[model samples]
Target chain A: MKKYTYTDKKDTRSGFGAGILELGRTNPNVVALTADLAGSLKLEGFIKEFPDRFIQCGISEANMIGVSAGLTIGGKIPFATTFANFATGRVYDQIRQSVAYSGKNVKICASHAGLTLGEDGATHQILEDLGMMKMLPNMTVITPCDYNQTKAATIAIADYQGPVYLRFGRPVIPIFTPADQKFEIGKALMLNEGPDVSIFATGHLVWEAIQAGEKLAEEGIEAEIINIHTIKPLDEEAILTSVRKTRCAVSAEEHQLNGGLGDSIAQTLARNYPAPLEMIGVHDSFGESGTPAQLMQKYGLTADKIVEAAKRAMERRV
Target chain B: METQQLEQIAVQVRRDILRMVHAVNSGHPGGSLGCTDLFVALYFDVLRLKRDDQGKVIFDMDGRDEDLFFLSNGHISPVWYSVLARAGYFPVSELSTFRKIDSRLQGHPATAEHLPGIRIASGSLGQGLSAACGAALAKRLNGDDKHVYVLMGDGEQQEGQVWEAASFAPHHKLGNLTAIIDLNHQQIDGPTDLVMNNRDLGEKYRAFGWNVTDMKGNDLADVLRTLHESKNDSEVPTLILMHTEMGYGVDFMMGSHKWHGVAPNDEQLATALNQLPITISDLKDY
Candidate 1:
């Protein structure tokens, strides 16, 4: 087992802000819009450098989505930022008709996703965003694990010519992935290779899965850790290849058990290869006011939950 | 174009509106008839559209040379399609394809089927204004400076997103954008006042920070003059409150909400066509 160390923790949105700044330097067509959450979404850097290109669309999320779609007409790549709840549920129809159905080159960058958006309660957190966004025909859903990966994904989506939902989180997590790692839109990253069991995780849950893999190694369990960032594309080849080797799997994410990353992997496995699988996510319930760490433990999204789910899935493998 | 010629086109547009609705047996005629003259004025006089002298030649130009129009209240597709056809965007014969399966002209105007003249899909009300605003912004970005026009039903003012867009354009100072409200006072259920009272729309737009203007939509001269005036104001996005009878031109259907979404019967269609001073052959060449 390889022990990963972190110098300092940072929220994934800062990585997005940095990536957008880099994009501004490289591509002049990349513009940004925020719905009164510019500071929260970490878009101040981009706003400062490219003030003319940055649109502050007040507190109206619906108008923001529409304006983002409109910005794509003259071949401008628009990145619209807001909270996950308002980004998806609040402006679904706007995104549907304007961005998604219209096939506009708009990146719907959402921060503070799922239960990890703690203390804001269920009203602010959204667990069904992945399902809602991925269900759209031309939508590309990406949920980066940490700061480095989020920055890489943001820069990457600027060149991708279609509607993309880039989901990130509020909490400062481990920055384990290499700083120079290139992000492929639909490709999953294999963290540690093993055959005992495959653990697929996304967003803020990736660090937890890595920790679980280290703990499982102490118990003589070789867990293969795979980062499934792009949930819509679902890296089916990588998932099936790993599941074939391990013969069992455990899926983890900060979203709900019904329509999160786990549900997507489960459906894929059910059709292609039958494998024993356990899901580590929030059950059928809304989140409450709590710290990020407390909510992770209370909602069964910690490293221990992943380790337990791995053992349970291995037991069912036969 | 002369006022008399524009009036002749308006009569022909009204005739097209009646025939298309009667053919489908399921379309909105009242607002379509009401907005006929305004659409005609926009396509014929106000807009810098590339057309031949005969008004039938498809002016070959790159996508960049195109001037765009979006019908936010797309229930009035008959008027828009008629005007587009009359303005040489496509063949006038395509007017027969309204609401028919395998037709580019859907019940609502959409770009999903790659309708050449339509830049965005706009069947769903209140969404088109934002889209038009987007297109207007795109024009600014492209440095094209081409105008973007959108039409919304007076009843469609109930949508919150419309106000959202209304508030947005002026803040951005989108001078290239123009939005017209078909102030026929009628919607799907009944009169807009009865269903959802849009109290003083001109004052409402003024409150939302738009340069407001009013015109009698059925009157060709007023439609042309108001639209021309709207183009001159470069600091604010223009909104025209086009006052018109729900069912204009047709005697039986005029001044009532009953003909809003209902198609005229066979006898009613004949009477409506007879009321027009122009013949169908004169419009068929358009």
Candidate 2:
């Protein structure tokens, strides 16, 4: 087993900030809008560089969503940033009517996603965001793995036209993916290829999946790890191909079990090729005040939980 | 156009409204009749859009490229479709297809079905003003100073998001946008005052940092004058609280909430049409 190392542990939002700045320089149509979460969403650099393009929409998320939709009329690409909870569930109707249904090419950049946005409690931690956003038509949902990939995903969504929801996290995690890798929207990145069990992971859980794969390898269980960054257009080919070979599947994410990445994978496999599947996510409950690490452990969202789910799924793979 | 001509158009529009409502047997007629004159003034004079222009028209008055109108209170499709038809946005004969199957004139104005004139689908209320502000902002971004006009029902203002947008537009100095409230004082339930008292709408908009104005929405001359006044003031977003009577014409339904969502029967339609000056010589039963 190979050990992954990182020089520093920085929040994935820094990657978003860096990507936005790069986008500002590359594309003139790129504009940023924030709902009084400039510092939190890490859009300060882009705002500083392109103050004219950066629209401070104050605390009104609904108005901000509408304004973003309107900005598309003049052929401007707007990337609206806010917390995942406020961006999706809080302004669901606004986004549904204005952006999604209207088919506006606005990138809804969301930060502090899932239960990993710790200490905020259940009020701010939105585990149902994926379900709410993915339900809308013409919406592309992307949840990148780490700092480098988050940056790559942010930059990629700018060029991809139509409405996109780019979900990132608040905590710092492993940055294993290459810095210069081009982020494809629906393409799943296969980290480890094996045949016993397939582990599909997204967002902050990708690193955990890799760790679980390593542990399973030591136990003579060859677990394949695939990072499903795009949840909406769930890379069906990669998922089905992997599940067909492995015969068992386990999905891990720091989100609720309902309408999460696991649900998407299960639906895909059930339709194409039914396989034994286990989901490692928050089991129908709200998060409480704790650190990201503590919450992940308590809510059964860890590498060990993935290993356990994988073992259980493998046992059911007759 | 002269006031008489505008009045004549309003009568024709009222006739069309009754016919369409009667045809569907399920459409809002109260706000439709209340907003006919404002629609007439907008299509006839205020908005510099052309009927035959294939491409988007850029009105030169705003010094921006294009001027567009969005109907947020889309339940009043009869008035907008009638005005668009009368103003030649589409064929006047198309008025017959109002809300029928396979017709561009949907129950609400939807751009999804490629309805030539409409830009966005707005029937839920409290969404159009914000969308209008966005289009105005886009115009500003495109270096097109063209003005954007949106109409809303006074009762729709009760939605909290409307004020959220109302407050946002002014704070951002979106002066290119003009929102008109059809102060017909009636919603589905009853009077706006009884349902939810929106007392001092002008002051409320002013408090939200909008340049508020008042006008008789049914008076063509007043609608024109007030809309022109709204265009002149570019320092802040303007809100026209146009006071209008619910069910303006047609003596039987005038000043009442009964016609808010009910369609007219054959006798009622005939009675309503007779009140208008226009001769419906060829009233086709669909």
Candidate 3:
């Protein structure tokens, strides 16, 4: 929990691809469908190894979601793979009617989520997918932190008997979470426990939270960093337990502040136990074409921002 | 079992559709009446669904190893719900609870209500065909030769997702799926041509690489023949464009798009019931 380090850095999408290949070997019922982004989503290994199990859905994301919903009827677990924009907002009605409302066990594995999908501009970079998917009934929204956690979460959701939105990114972030860690759906991973402030981070921001935690530790602020992988079935208890001890909280994510991880934590705190909170994310602006690192800094989704927000939240602590 | 018997059941299903809509005053009767014969022909005779040891249809969400049907143009819940009950998917008496609060018979066909025959929710148009394509692909993967069927309205063709699915089925060679479009030429707005004309839908499907078939939707014998022809064309997915009048059975409502989503008043309901002669008596009337 002190200082975290990574031996390698890889894109989380590759972990999704690796996870698909693993499912191809183990679960006969698992099938992968992609909207012509197999290469971007890193699904070549699964496609080559289990060609029969892979479906190339062309550029039709709506049909892919509907098809994924249908595959569940005949006892096949379908992972409908696409970019975050095409996966959630584009085919939201298809997901709502067929997957979520119908209670079909389809895993909507989305790659290139958030501002971290560098240089594609705002059209390809989807910041509202988490909120869109989470608002639907029977939808499990997940944003795993690293490659290992993304891979683990990919395999873990197939066992769940409902629809899931597993959001990952194209950027090569650090692989800090253990490769052999058993992925729990709603359980938050306590990366670092402290009493000063609670830093709840998800997706790409989890690594940034650790960076901020170290910097805060040098300033004599022991920040509690908890990785909130599952955003919809949020580990409310973990949030409460951490925030109750710290008396203040800061939520970080590579998304909008309005409906991202921060809003989930805000609502939980407001209902169960009121606490001073600061949110670190994009403040209602579309991301432009830029490097992932540049975009993170520009959108206020970096470690310095988290540290700044943490200090602000600590200042407002009663 | 016989065409005559199927017609007898169709008459009662029509009565149920009219009465169900009349009771609720908030259901689609035009499309429901239009697709009555097709629904009866499929559920009562054509579909090869899984039966128990004693021949009772086993109703499960994951209907593996059996034929599956998904209704995409689900505004016609009256027709589907009545047919399912008449097919013994649920008690016919429960049909009385159609559109009532907390009843399983929702305004649209939804799996959330745990309805026996419905595999997925559909009311928002243009999604069912893709689901059928997926189910057909699943059948191919599982090595189960059982079929997947889906029904869509003609006006529902305006949805771009339908074309996405239309292109997919033949491209993937989903021969195990049969997609039927009720060519009622009517949506909630008005005539489909007046709304947005989809010129030659069968030609469009054929261009999309489907084995296109034309069926007289209201005609029971033609519906059965189309089903047989479609069931045999298992190398490429078949699209049966079922040309039907908007309101087929009732003399006054026949061929009118005005009844597309409007429930009949008391007088109109009585008039519609008078035109339909019930012959299937073994099933309880809702």
Q: Which candidate's TM-score is highest?
A: 3
Candidate 3 residue lDDT tens string, A1-318: 487889999999999989888988999999999999989989899988888899999999999999998889889999999999999999888999999999999999999999988898999999999999989989899999999999999989988888999999999889999999999999999999899999999999999999999999999999999999999899999999998899999999988887889999999999999999999988998999999989988888889989999999999999
Off by over 4 Å in 3: B282-286
DockQ of every model listed? 0.50, 0.46, 0.89
Ranking by TM-score: 3, 2, 1
Clashing pairs in 1: none
RMSD of each: 2.8, 2.6, 1.2
| Per-residue lDDT of model 1, residues B1-286, tens digit only | 8988888888888888888988889888998888888888888888776545774535421224446667888888888888888776777898888899999988887666666566566667788888777777777777886787888988889999998899999999999889999888888788889999999999988988899998888888888888878877776899999999988988998889999899999999888888986733544422
Q: What's the residue-level lDDT of A254 in candidate 2?
A: 83
lDDT of 2 by residue, A5-84 (tens): 66766778889999999999999889899999999988888888899888888888988888888777777899999999
Counting clashing residue pairs in each candidate, in order, gives 0, 3, 0
* C-alpha positional error of residue A15 in candidate 1 after TM-score superposition, expressed in Å: 0.8
Q: Write the per-residue lDDT of candidate 3 for residues B147-188, one digit (tens) a residue.
A: 888999989999999999998998988888899999988777
Q: Positional deviation of A68 in candidate 3, in angstroms? A: 0.6
lDDT of each: 0.86, 0.86, 0.91
User: If scored against the real structure, what TM-score would every candidate get?
Assistant: 0.93, 0.94, 0.98
Please list the residue runs of candidate 1 whose C-alpha ends up more than 4 Å from where it truly belongs after superposition. A1-3, B50-67, B91-93, B277-286
